[model samples]
Target: MKVQNKIVVVTGGGSGLGRELVLALLSSGASVAAMDINAAGLEETVALAGMNRGNLATYALNITDRAAVEALPEQVIARFGAVDGIINNAGVIQPFVRLKDLDYAAIDRVMNVNLFGTLYMTKAFLPHLLARPEAHITNISSMGGFLPVPGQTIYGASKAAVKLLTEGLSSELLGTNVRVTVVLPGAMGTNIAVNSGVMDTLEVKGGEAPVKMLAPDKAARIIIDGIENNRFRVLVGADARLMDAVYRLNPQRAARFIYDQMKALLPQ
Candidate 1:
C-alpha cells in the first residue's frame, strides 16, 4: 500500500529509527501519529518535523501496556480522522551477558518490550486496519532474530518470536485488505543500549575493532519503501543482507562467525 495519503502510526517515535520514520513519512506526504514513552523525546521529534509538524500527531505511550495500546487507535483516529497503518518499532535489547548469568528481571523486560509490545500493538490496531480499504502492519525484527549472537541470546529469542509472529500474521491476513511486513535490521547507529540501560555492561576490549552501524535514517527509508510496496520482508543494512544469505547457506558457520565478531563485547 502506498503511504502518500495514508495516516500511519509509528511506535518508538521518540528517538532513533522511530523518529526518522515519522519525518520520512511526513516527507512522503503521509500523516503520522508518532508514539513513544518519552514525552520529551516526542516533543523533540515534533520540533524536528518543522513545517510538516501539522501533518503529524505525537502520543506518549508505552506499547507494552495493553490497556494503553488498546486505546491508542481511537486517539490516533481522532487526530487523523482514520488510521491506515501501524509500525511496531519499539523494542529493547538484553544486557550483553550469557543466558546462564542473566537475571530473570532482564529477560522479562526484554520479552515484554520486544515480543509482547509488538503483539499488543498489532492486536489493538488490527481491527482498525481491517476496516480500512487498504492498511498495513510493520514489525521490526533484528539480524539476531535469525542468527545467534552468544551474549544476546534472549534478545534474539524475542526478536525471533517477532519474526514468526509477523510472518504468521501476514499469512492469516492474506485475502484481507491489511498487509503485514517483517523487518530484519542489522546494527544501526542508535542509542538503544543507553535507552535500554545496558550500555555500561556492553563493553569492548581496548584494542578491538569498532563495529560498523547503519545510519538510522537510511534504515527508516528502507522500511518505508517496504510499507509502500507491501513487501513481505524487509532487510536493512548490508550486514543484515549478507548474514541472511550466509545463515541460509550454513547456519553453523554463520553462528560461529557472529560469535567471533561479538565475543569481544561479552564479559571476560
Candidate 2:
C-alpha cells in the first residue's frame, strides 16, 4: 500500500503512537482522517502535521460509539471519495491490577475502548475498503496480547482478543482485495499511561522503568512498512519478538516468566 495519495483513517489519532502514525502517513502523501475522542488532541495533531487542506482531516468521535463509527465511512467517502485503509489504533491501558482487585467499571472501559473499538472501526470501514484494489486494515495489539500479564489481566485479555481477531480476519479475508495485519508492540516511549488515565496507578516491576521501550516514531515507521508490504504480523521491538518466541516455544513457561518478572508491579 504505497500510501501516496491514498485515504487512511487512524483511530486515537490525537496522541501517542496514533499521532505519530498519522504524521508519518501524511508525510507519505496519504490523505488522512485522524479520528479520536479527544478533540483538542486531534487539533494538535493536525497542527503538527501541517498538511494542506484536503490532505488531512480530523474526526472527534468515540470509537465505542457504534452509530458514529458506522457513519464514518460516508463522511470519509464524501471527503476522500473512497476509504483505502484503516488503522484501529485507539486503545487504553489501566494500572496493573489483578482481576479480582480490579473495578468492574475499569474492566469494561478497557474492553470497550480496546476490543470493541477495534471491532466497530473494522466493521464500519470494511465495505468501503473492499471497494478498493489493495485495501489494508492494521490492528495494533500488544506484547500483553501474546503473553499473559498477571496484574494487568484485563488489558491482556483485550489485546489477546485483538490478536486472534486480526488473525481470524486475515484468514477470512484471504481471497479478498482487503488485507488484515496485526501489530504487537512492546513498551514504547509514548503517553499511553497518561492518556489512558492510569499514570498515577502504574507501577514498575524489577525496580526499573521496563526494557525494550522503543520510541513512538520508530514504531510508527515499522507499522507503515508492514501495511505497505501487507505483512501478517509485525512485532515492534526485540522484546516483543523474544517474548513471542518464548511463548510459542513453551506457553506455560513463558507465562511463568512473565509472572515472575512482573511480580513487583502486582498489588500487595
User: Which number leads on TM-score?
Assistant: 1
Kindly list the per-residue Cα lDDT of model 2 for residues 161-264, writing each as its tens digit: 99999999999999999988999998898998888888876666544774657999999999999999989999999889898999999999999988877777
Tell me which residue pairs clash in candidate 1: none
Count of backbone clashes, every candidate in sequence: 0, 0
What TM-scores do the predictions have? 0.98, 0.96
* Residue pair clashes in candidate 2: none
| lDDT accuracy of residue 172 in candidate 2 | 94
Q: What's model 2's TM-score?
A: 0.96
